[model samples]
Target: MPLSSLPAPTSSRRVLITGAASGLGLALARGLAERGDRVLATDVARARPDSVPAGVDYLPLDVRLDADWTSALAHVRDSWGGVDVLVNNAGVATGGRIDVATMDEWHRIVDINLLGVVRGCRTFTPLLKEQGRGHIVNVASLAGLVHAPGMASYNAVKAGVVAVSETLDHELAPHGIAVSVVCPAFFRTNLGASFAGADGDMEAAGKRLLERSRRSADEVAAIVISGIDARRDIILTDWDGRIAWRVKRFARPIYRLAMRRAGARIASTSHTIE
Candidate 1:
């Protein structure tokens, strides 16, 4: 379907969001449901989260598990006939310099952050193909595009999400499936709780950034919904992200210098316990 074929804003599309127990995922679920969309809000927890908004359905879905995806698909088919939108929002947070980060850390982040989105896309693309009209939204981060220091694993995986979303936008356009990748800069969320890195200071630094952010998850979720309605292929949800991306694209010299300085500062500050 063409971008113009997307359902109208007033239409109540069936939407499914992963990691809906908390953070941006929870906010998306709430916003979409309040807008009258039939929402299935899923998380890794087996029991329904009390934080889930009223009238929204709940399911247990660990994106890293194949069986969970199968079950989610079954539920969607049985309950909603089929999905009109899929939001792959589940991910973990990790940060470390190349040498400081362990292979296990790299593998775990890739499995949960990058491949998790990949699995969601693979699982639902066939249904969207048959329907010939649907949307897939992947939640990435500014780190995906604006690579800074001490977050190599996170940057790589988020960049992967952006790449995969772009590829699918083209590949699925012929099949009438719209794909969007959302890259929001840091915001106030419990994402810091999920932080896993070789250096404790890296996690501390990430938390500080999150604490300092002006944007909230709810605000970002609203932006994402608007972007999806507009059928945007790349949605940058904040000014910081937009500015950073523009600088990287249009002012390479400045961006490079900034990154070098950030890297040097991090290298000087980062400390790992033996």
Candidate 2:
């Protein structure tokens, strides 16, 4: 089917989001539902009715498990016929340098952040193909594009998401499926809960991230929705992210130098960590 023949994704779309119990995912679920989109919000925990939008459906989903995704997709298929938008927004953050980071930590982070997105895309893509049109949005971080100290695993996985989304956008665009990757700076979210390793270090890093947050989850949610509506393949949340992206692209040596200095400063004396 041609793009011209596909249904317009407006208020009528069936939207599904991962990690919807709190933070950005919860905000997205509520934002979409409030705007009249049929929204299904899923996470490992059930969302409080007070937090979820009036008309939204909540589910328990462990994004690392394919079976969990299967059950959610089944529900959407049975109830709404098919989903028009899929959000791979579940992820974990582990704060440590490579020397301090453990293999177990790496595996856990990769399983949820990178492979999690891959699994979600692999599972629902066929349905999008069958339906002729749909959109997939993967939530990454500014860490992906900008390499920083003490976030080795996070940087790797999020970079993978950006790379994967770019490839998917081109490959699936021909099939009428739009793919986008959203890279946002630090935000006030529950990401701290997913931090791994030393509790003290993690707590410090988590607090720093929260303190650096320039926007709220609800604010990010609105930008995300607008990005998807525009079919933007690469979505940066703030002007700071935009500036860094440009510097990284146009002045590689300078960006690398800054990152190197940053890495050294954090390892040596800085209090904040990404």
Candidate 3:
């Protein structure tokens, strides 16, 4: 369906977004607020912006905590009557080979990146069902579709996200709740800064990668909003991501060869342990 033909934002278009303090989450909140939707933005940090647009509200939330999700959803239910959208945009990244990475690091990454999405979906799916009509947008990544060395855990978690979201889309479609998984290539965000590391070199490498493929957060936000508007099941944020998906699907040998070449580069890095 065309974006123009999608459901228009009315007072009833209530949206709740996680990780709204910065990056794509903030951009999405601002865009949706500008479009006249009542937006409830939440982040784990206490120092959220003091003011948002008149229709936008801010809440404190830690996606890993069940209590936080419950409180956030209850607040939305009471204030907006029902939530029309839920954006599970909160995530963190960890880079290293699975074998070399510390178990603690692996747990932390999975807690925030994979299980966070799982928790969000588990908590909000019922709320969306209660509303009878709603959209769930889960932000995965281009990495979810293909393996990248040094990002073994990250890629695994994102792959799980894609699987869970696709399943949800099938399960929720009959109830008028549309689930869309967004696969975005690198974007200009503070995600690199948020990378947890026990050493300096790993952190530096993460920063370099973040800077390399940076795109404006607003651009990604626009794609997400447009996807929601059009009720698209899969939203690819960049041309590279689209191309990668096509190659992976129709040109398996070529895709595998490309992955092998990319993996060699990543493996050669002293910073990345195989």
Instruction: Provide TM-scores for the models.
Output: 0.96, 0.91, 0.90
Pairs of colliding residues, candidate 3: none
Q: Write the per-residue lDDT of candidate 1 for residues 112-206, one digit (tens) a residue.
A: 99999999999999899889999999998888899998888999999999999999999999998999999999999999999866778788888
In angstroms, give how far residue 129 of model 2 lies from its true place: 0.3
On TM-score, the leading prediction is 1
In candidate 1, which residue pairs get closer than 3 Å at backbone N, Cα or C atoms, i.e. clash?
A: 1-176
Count clashes in each candidate, considering only residues at least 3 apart in sequence or on different chains: 1, 0, 0
The lDDT leader among the candidates is 1
Better of 2 and 3 by lDDT: 2
Candidate 1 deviant stretches above 4 angstroms: 1-8
What overall lDDT, based on C-alpha atoms, would model 2 receive against the true structure? 0.83
Report the C-alpha displacement of residue 213, candidate 2, in angstroms: 1.9
The order by descending lDDT is 1, 2, 3
Q: Candidate 3 versus the native: TM-score?
A: 0.90
| Model 3 per-residue lDDT tens digits across residues 1-274 | 2223334464547889998888888888888877777889999976567544456788988988999989987898788777888999999877775556778877887898788898988888898887788899998998888766667778888998899899999999998999999889887888987777553445667678678865788878887888888889888989988998899999999998988997777567665432
